[model samples]
Target: MFNGKFLTPCFKSKQPWKRLLSTQPSVVLAMSGGVDSSVSAALLKQQGYKVQGVYMRNWDSLDEVGHCTSKADWEDVQKVCSILDIECSQVDFVKEYWNNVFEKTLTDYAQGVTPNPDIGCNSFIKFGSLLDKIPEGTWFATGHYCRTNNGKLLRGLERNKDQSYYLSTVPEAALRRTLFPLGEIESKVKVKQLATDFGLLDIAKKKESMGICFVGQKRKFASFLQEYIDQPPGPVIDLDSGKVIGQHEGLYGYTIGQASRICHGSHKWFVADKLLDQNKLVCVAGSNHPALFSDTLVAKNWTWIHHQIPTLPVQVDAQVRYRQSPEKAILSQTPDGQYALRFTHPIRAIARGQQVVVWDQDWCLGGGVIDAVL
Candidate 1:
């Protein structure tokens, strides 16, 4: 199904899939009905591991247009499992997801801070509740584009599609039992090719999902959030002019570095900050305004994958958001015992409540939540 032009680079860089021998023989894979997971199941079966697929039903409601997205995905899972000769089942985690991930996300937004729900889902749902519900001693596997080396989290071979950032919050114990079959695959193009070879042409051509799973592609994020969170309107003020430019429906609708849609003027206005006490949305005139950048940030709830904190003032590559290149920074502990990251150069749009994942070359050291921007 891949174009010839796209397959050339993938073929050149493709490496032999290393066959792993498992002492436990049985594996439980989290199948999301995506090409990545489908390929992972095939690879696991090829390795002689008895595979069982479990589809997590995290969101129970229909999409904005009254379409049941989860139902369609489950149907795909059944088709893939039938081809692979593996048993498949579904688990209901809707209540757990609401309490652990969604509730905390709404709370962060209501407080005028940006939060990453996908990070929370990985930490709390996939690695937390799912692990607890599964039978003990059964090795767990997923389609995550990451690797675990001797209980240490490692970046996948595909640098552009590496997903170690989302799994930074997962505990070390969880990593020890996890298997990532797609970790060594050179590119997503190769994954799709492998899926087609495994007789999963429909899944191989399926579009890659983005953003939060609960918020469907057809839905407006702000409108979906407003249905659950009750927020009042606030004033939108120009940062440079110090004048009220317009009114915002709610502070939750805007995030730092996002373009302000309500404020129309000669210059495009970007959200610079949120004045929570005064309930004001500060907007800067230009996209590259100095107010949008910060050289340092304070993060709390620090978690190391190996459960061992690093020495102070250590230099490493860090990223404030997913898909962003990791930048050089020094991570040190403050005198008051809080952890802080000081970038070698200024970083842009370091938002509060978002995560800061650090890496030491190919190894993911782990990360923390951005509590304050300095």
Candidate 2:
């Protein structure tokens, strides 16, 4: 139990700050100016804990187009901080992002795979990159809906909305210091109530951001690849004849499951494979391409949060993307410590650079950047 002052105002109001501060633990809130984070900040202040807002300024290349990371978000964050009566600081992570996170992701994507950047942002930037700035004994909290029990990360109360996949890469070292304030709450109605009750309704009804990912409404993967990964122009081949049917701008820019983008005379297409050796982009038209789906995925940059890789025949559930359902799998660990997941059912186009989050049921076992889909 916290030995600080009596929970006079805090216990009465059911604010987390009062609940957490009975032990006098200082807290730093990653305020994004959204209603959820705003409510978090407000509740923390009302409970009388030492609270401050730390907004991470990420790389959106806003100066180039003169937009994005919009002013509205900043203004909203400022308003919330004013209401909460706390100091706000902007932390720069652009350098670390490119050097520590982005560099490695692009390398994986060049070989033809789907990469999720939010994993890096969560594991490295939002958590790993900000440790030193927090005052001694202060714990770090974010607007994430997930929860952690005594430093053991767990799924959120809202199963449909869990972000554990992206957050699955957080190292154990950073996990010990992190807190998730929104872990136990339901989404939508409850979130609105929190906003309405706190007199932040104007912005409370606002839609939440997807995170620091730089994608746009359309598929930005092409542009992302063009900027970071080089794609030499190559021949688009007919799978049967292995003859050149058309041309593609770059072979590295395509994935196993994507077909509509390739201009193959509207015959319908399924990517069979990217043959860098043959310098050809292979596709099957209006038919099954069994080779595209793989029963196993070769995952590199393997990370085990709770413990090291389990012994052979390790039981784990693997997810290719945040929304994908969990798949039963066996992980084979290499002598060098890299691991590959062999799924019971073949997963479609298990791309090269996408992150693979393995779970031991509700507990996020850990994750890593997808190295290859073998």
- Which tens-of-lDDT digit does each residue in 1-374 have in candidate 1? 11111111111123111112456377878899999999999999999887877788888777674344687788888789888887676777888899999999999999988999999998998899887665556789999999999889999998999999999999888999999999999999999999999999999999887646677767778988898888889888988888999999888988999888865678889999999889999999888999999999999998989866677789999999997999999999888777899999999889998999999898899899999999
* Model 1 misplaced regions, further than 4 Å: 1-24, 66-68
Best prediction by TM-score: 1
Worst 10 residues of 1 by lDDT: 1-10
lDDT of 2: 0.70
Instruction: Estimate candidate 2's RMSD in Å.
Output: 6.4
Report, for every candidate in turn, its global Cα lDDT versus the true structure: 0.85, 0.70
Error of 1 at 46 (Å): 0.7
Q: Name the TM-score of candidate 1.
A: 0.92
Model 1 residue 349 CA deviation (Å) reads 0.7
- Candidate 2 error regions (>4 Å): 1-24, 46-48, 63-66, 211-219, 228-230, 277-279, 286-288
Question: lDDT by residue for model 2 over 1-374, one digit each (tens)?
Answer: 12212112211223323224355557788877787778777667666666767666666464332345544566777666766566665556767788777776776567555667777777777877676555557777787778886556788877777878878878776777877767788675676688778888776888766644454423455665687666678888878877778887777677777773566666887777777766778887754567667887777777788755466768788898888888999877866778878899988767677788888788888877777677
